[model samples]
Target chain A: MAAAWHVRGLVLALLLAAVEGRAEPPEEESPWFVPDHAALQLAGSIGLLSAGPGWGFLRDGVDAELLLGWAPPAVAGEDFLTVTLKGQWHPFRPAWRGWTLRPLTVGLLLSYTFGDAYFVGLPDRYPDGYYWFKTALRPALLLGAGAGRPVPALGLRLQGYAELVATDYRLLHFLQSPATAGTGLFSLALGVRVRF
Target chain B: MDGPLRFAVLGDIQLFLDDGADAVEDLRRRDVDFVVQLGDLTEYGSAQEYAWVAELFDRLPVPSFAVLGNHDVLGTGADIYRRTFGPPFLSFQHAGSRFVLFDSNSREYAFPGNVPDLEALGEALAPEPGVDHRFTFSHVPPWNGDFDAALTGPLEQLQAERGVSASFHAHLHQFESEVRRGVPYFVADSLEHRNYLVVAVDGPVVRVERVFY
Candidate 1:
């Protein structure tokens, strides 16, 4: 029922967990409340580019992140800003020569755009059910994979990942107009993660 | 450019992208002087939807124009519409016929009452030489609830006085045609209905037909 800009978000934790997520408690026992990684992503539906903090859980199998996204008028055809909350679950982590890879990743995210024109709640303009979806908030589905390698000297891990994002509006249209929206249903996003 | 002025008018495309695409393909085969989409080009009026619809319009070889729709005004959609297709209101004379397109979706702005802009319509439809027929295009028919209730009568009266051959609209999502105050009003169905309208004017006579894609 709704479709907007092709923005994408979050895949920060999979690679962070792949690096030191084997639960080596004695090596670096930090507070669980502290974030395990930070990520900067390009073209994930959240924006043309976004950066955020992420937390890894379930022995690095699960990830939660908060991202701040932006799109400049030059690239997006106009200026746009968004905040996104994303969660992901990685199923497989294989290592080769000290580089860990997550082959399969699946996730969900909800994004909120910042502007006076957008509304979380319906204005007094129409009936109770004028619009079923909120213009300010967007929910989407995510599928992607990533790989990470530890840099011992720098005490940080470098990771790279990519995702195919299907926002709620796009998914809805895909369900109805398969022939028209089939190829455009999902937008691609690439991102990098730095494990602390 | 020849004997008769023939143009195609498409109603609300909305979410039916494939239908709209099919219509475009169907239109490419026909001989039309130009094409006018009555608006609601996008479902939510999002940037990507605008891009998709714009891409569709670009596929047409004939010159095409779109009026503003309520959905097209959602969020920053109006701004996007401007970026994609010039301004909301446009008036020009082509082949001895006056074609006027403007914004009539008053409820989108909570019905500030100035929508439909009769003053502008009066000026655009002013008596001019070589103009034997006049046509108007917009979203939301006057009878629809989305249109400003206060301005409907005034709008109809103005069209009647201006001798507008026919007023075209899309928003009801169904084909409807009726005469009010001696002027004919045509409401085009959404693209999902798979039907469009064709208007042809020759000399002082004008004819409209419902076309199926």
Candidate 2:
């Protein structure tokens, strides 16, 4: 299972790199004060999806934004709210006329979850005394990198992002049971971002 | 040579410390792609317990993957799991299916959104253009107080939206099957019962049989 995640991580990294490599110098300079714009997004994979809005400020074609997202849970069966702070350097300034790395952005995120512990599918050996589902506090640190290119012809902004989750798993799971301990939970994600 | 893959899912092999040898021997007689240990393979997540479980898994003929359980995280025990197994939450593909293994054991400590790490699960579950089945493995389920309930509904919905074939979890020790938001959640039996879930898949078709050994 570990090997497969590595392969997928590599694919995502390469794709992000390729997209960033398409950047080009800006065609025209916009007033720094205009503060580019903002967008709403919906993203998901497997049985998880998150949607929310972000506000972006543009200066010399560089954009920085803060995002707030929430997921209702799908496969894992939970819900959470996440806040992300990000900065983007779009060298291509919205469009790439030729070969340029376009817009490359990197940022950090933090999230929190609410509700009781349902502890979905544990085996029979784990007794009721062993675990708890309602974790009041949970936080994660994510280092992310992303790139985008605008395809006016297709009426979309094509972008991709890769994020690494850094956090402790046991604390997050908060297993009150004797059966759980030690393990930390973290993740990496690469996905395309489309603006309609 | 193309056939279904067979493997075992063992949950919380704790306290039984001395009873493990028999389970190891039983596994030797089976043909499997690999074995997946659901977590709590140790009593205290101690190096000593980990070493014992490592030896047991080593006895298997096929490779094995494991998720880090809460019990495996106390003191230096968590460090032991990383050194002995690999990552806590992980994802992989075998026999044409995608297996997303992640850590859901929350509350031994706390993070802003660290426990469930929904983003990570989302990434692991994201559609693989060509893969026929998507399966999720974790030590704790959303219902457990140790898990974040807020993330459960979203996770179930995502699995349904993403077309996940099934979700696997251990920590409860009993065997069960339920549909949450239209997704099948299978909880395997513990080693004490000498039973495990054996999953076989061919494209979109999957067969899960309870095996004792």
Candidate 3:
């Protein structure tokens, strides 16, 4: 239990560091490793809330993020911890009424959970091909839109986004029951990203 | 304020959640007093799946109960099960009939020998003046290979000694029943097969029937 809290502490510290950094760094002072943005999200399959550091490239059109997620027992019926890597592409960004809108954003994320019961490969107790999918790692496809505007005082761009996440497990079950899978085919995640 | 005690027992849900939904609808229309799902609620035992299944169960017009199956022990699945359905070995009485639910997926724990915990089950099945009938439910049957082979005879003997009216199980995914030492053992059919078991007890007699949906 102490180990779990220690890991959680480390992740929290990392996210806090990203959030507390300078609003603006001169081109010469900023290194490639410095994150371009920081994000906080809620209600993704990975966790009830997730926070991360994100890198923006290709004229801020493409993004890569590393997130730490946690779901408390109060909401999720059980405690959950996950680390997610996400990649996204925004093909079009339109400015309307001082708000920049990402008309289309396509993304994918792979998340890994921490626990002894979850295994990436079959355990020795089971024979070959006992189970196909890994419970420890989950990959999801994301589709949605976002809009943001410059915050002059903070020297940052604040963006709000919504994503429809279709996890691998949900997709697998979808084949068996489209009617039941119905709206459950996708879970909604909402978040805010702050870019320096 | 009485009639025959009516309850429905469903088999492994696993990937057949749609079928599970349909079964709940059928049970509602049939007017059962309560319902029980034998186990294997999810294939991978993901929290999303557990949450989805909880929603499906809540749709039932009657109270519901569930047992832990082999698949439900994957990852932190067992803990999730406890959080969702309470401790695995549960005993309760409704309408003078006793119901006992326990974990029989010994193989999931690598045959820990006490997976079924016969001593606890014996206590749960102990007769009381008010309790008119006894029924026990678990995932793997005592005779199945997945069950703790060493504990089979003892389990069967215990159930027989207790005069259990019926012992129900699911995991073979098919419906089968036979008399073991004069007591009935019924294996429920999984939702994939489009059928479920309904048990009705009248006074001293218990009747179980398969209803195809």
Q: Against the true structure, whose TM-score is highest?
A: 1
| lDDT tens per residue, model 1, B1-213 | 457899999998878988999999999999898999999998777887888888888989999999999888877889899999999999989988899999999888899999989999999999998888899999989988889999999999999999999999998898999999999999988999998999988887888999997
How does residue A166 of candidate 3 score in lDDT?
91
DockQ in order: 0.42, 0.01, 0.45
Over the full model, what C-alpha lDDT does candidate 2 score relative to the true structure? 0.60
Candidate with top lDDT is: 3
Candidate 3 deviant stretches above 4 angstroms: A1-34, B1-4, B130-132, B202-205
Relative to the unseen true structure, what is the C-alpha lDDT of residue A34 in candidate 1, on a scale of 0 to 100? 62
lDDT of 1 by residue, A45-101 (tens): 788988777888988888888788888976555577788899999999889899999
Worst 10 residues of 2 chain A by lDDT: A44-53
Give the B-chain TM-score of model 3: 0.98
Please state the error at residue A119 of candidate 3 in Å.
Answer: 2.3
- Off by more than 4 A, model 2: A1-196
Lowest-lDDT window of 10 residues in candidate 3 chain A?
A20-29
Give the per-residue lDDT digits (tens) of candidate 3, residues A101-182.
9988999999987756677877776677767878789999999899999999987899999999999989878888787778
TM-score of chain A of each: 0.83, 0.42, 0.88
Ranking of predictions according to TM-score: 1, 3, 2
